[model samples]
Target: MPGKDAHNDTPRRVLDANFPDLALPAAVAARLPALVHCRRLASGRSLFVPGHRPTAFYAVAAGEIEARFTGLDGTVSVIEHVGAPRLFGLAAFAAGQPTEYEAVARGASEVLVIGREAYVLLMDEMPGFARALLAEFARRHDGTLRLLQAARHQSAAERFVLALAQLARERGRAAGDGWLEVTATQAELARLAHLSRQTANELLASAEAAGRVRRGRGHWLWRGDRE
Candidate 1:
């Protein structure tokens, strides 16, 4: 279970760090401190499950959240790993629909949640907030299209490489000269690339041989100069 923190006041720096996608004006920003609350989640705890109606928008303040989809047969697939400073559940929340996937904390995490009423108020009164939200939606739309195109036309190895590249760009940290470390297990990479674990392993071996990637225990170091 997620626990609400007693100290729920959202600071300006925290807001700037977590909601970088939203370019809120000073007026809109002034209102957020009162509208947002913080919740802490233990690893493997669910923030929200499928068919649940979203009452708030969430931005990861720390750690990661895994968005997963469960099929009729109960096979679960990882849809996305929403990491710190990223927003999740926006599509369902904005559309007033029940969430189709479960959002679970991947590690001990904290999130800043803005209730629906507050979101609506901002949307209605703040042009900057509305515009920023629309812009983020458009950006996600383009990213989804690219992923679909890659899945349709790219080879398995190509798809795997692309997935790694995307993760490295989005979630990786500088691991010294010319190397970027991405905190992801091979299973997570396989799921993200829509490849079997064995296939991902084989591709990774090949990439390792070619001096493209170095797999660590729970992460991968990508050569920044490599494609």
Candidate 2:
């Protein structure tokens, strides 16, 4: 079976198809030094929180970021896991709204922070670059909606299977014998699947009994044959 480290090796083909060769324009890239900056985050550090005014656009340069929404009752739901070379937090910039989710680093990570003024300037002067990013935004938005719908309509076991497959695609890598692996705590999996922790645990145990999965330290193995 693969391990936690293998999760970082997964190819984001779904997003990558639309986001192929994404890059800032030369002029915009050059101006980034003045209008944008980079930061390194230790694992568990928050990049932004709900209700924060959008000051800048963010892109992950390395490592993973977990996006989560917290309800009025303080219940937290995992929205998605974003990996390196991907943009996030664009909703606030595009709509001029306060952020609705908290984005946290999943591990040691680096991010590009582009200031609002520069972001607008680039959009005006670099329409191609802007269009590319908009496509990514659209794709992410649709995916999020689908995940939410799945959470609302699917059974607990079905939701867990769906979430497991998604995470595997986004963050896992293949092991021998048609297995995939990812490094995620059961709590994180529960949040991602929108299931209670006990429900996730029970479902996973059933999966294991059915020979569809195997649990490991800080990670889980999924049988590709099953999903």
Candidate 3:
């Protein structure tokens, strides 16, 4: 009965010292310790696999998680990265179904797991917390919509420019020499631009050549207005 396997005996994760204080109702926050436990994870650990029955929603209290998708052809897809205080398994917990993606630990991590039933009950009792969670989901949805549009509608150059512009606005620091503090990796920047890694590298080089931007050791600087 692999399909009916149960995870009732799974270990729990609690709030870690490094974890940020989540915006939950006072009552919900008080009861959260009862529902969630703390866990110490090893690097590259698999939290859950796709298609497995999901029993709880996980929050990374002290580290990071990677959301991954596995195709029928065995291709592994890196869907997204989630940092501390972010929630995973919400879809499975919300839909009462298996998780759509696998979650893995990127490094040694402390995580909290709230059982599905407990989460639902807490949400029903704390409408404010539920609203906050819903708002976060909506924000992610909007970002996904924009990513889809960029992938399908925009040229690679347009996507590159747009992504740089958005990052500059969101994470840019003081304008001395116009340096940006964004620390996105090449892979991450490629994902943001909705382009392949090679294409992204080429475009970045092109931007530098045209004096549109300067890639630094740990930051970027807007160098030109070229397109």
Tell me the whole-model lDDT of each prediction, alpha carbons only. Answer: 0.78, 0.76, 0.65
Consecutive 10-residue window with the lowest summed lDDT within model 2: 6-15
Pairs of colliding residues, candidate 1: none
TM values, all candidates: 0.80, 0.73, 0.67
Tens-digit lDDT string for candidate 2 (1-227): 33433322222321244356754456654554566556789999999898888778777767989999888898888888887667788899678898889999988987777677767766776547577877777877887887888889878777788788767866687877888888788887898998888999999899998899899989988985673
Worst 10 residues of 1 by lDDT: 1-10
TM-score of 3: 0.67
lDDT at 153 for candidate 3?
91
User: RMSD (Cα, Å) of candidate 3?
Assistant: 7.8
The runs of at least 3 residues in candidate 1 whose Cα sits more than 4 Å from the true structure, single-residue gaps closed, are 1-11, 18-30, 121-127, 145-154, 175-179, 223-225
Query: 34-82, model 3: which lDDT tens digit per residue?
Result: 5656667799998888778877777776777777777799855555566
State the lDDT of candidate 1 residue by residue for 154-204, as single tens digits.
Answer: 889877876787678568899887889998889888987878999999999
**What is the overall TM-score of model 1 with all chains considered together?**
0.80
Best by TM-score: 1
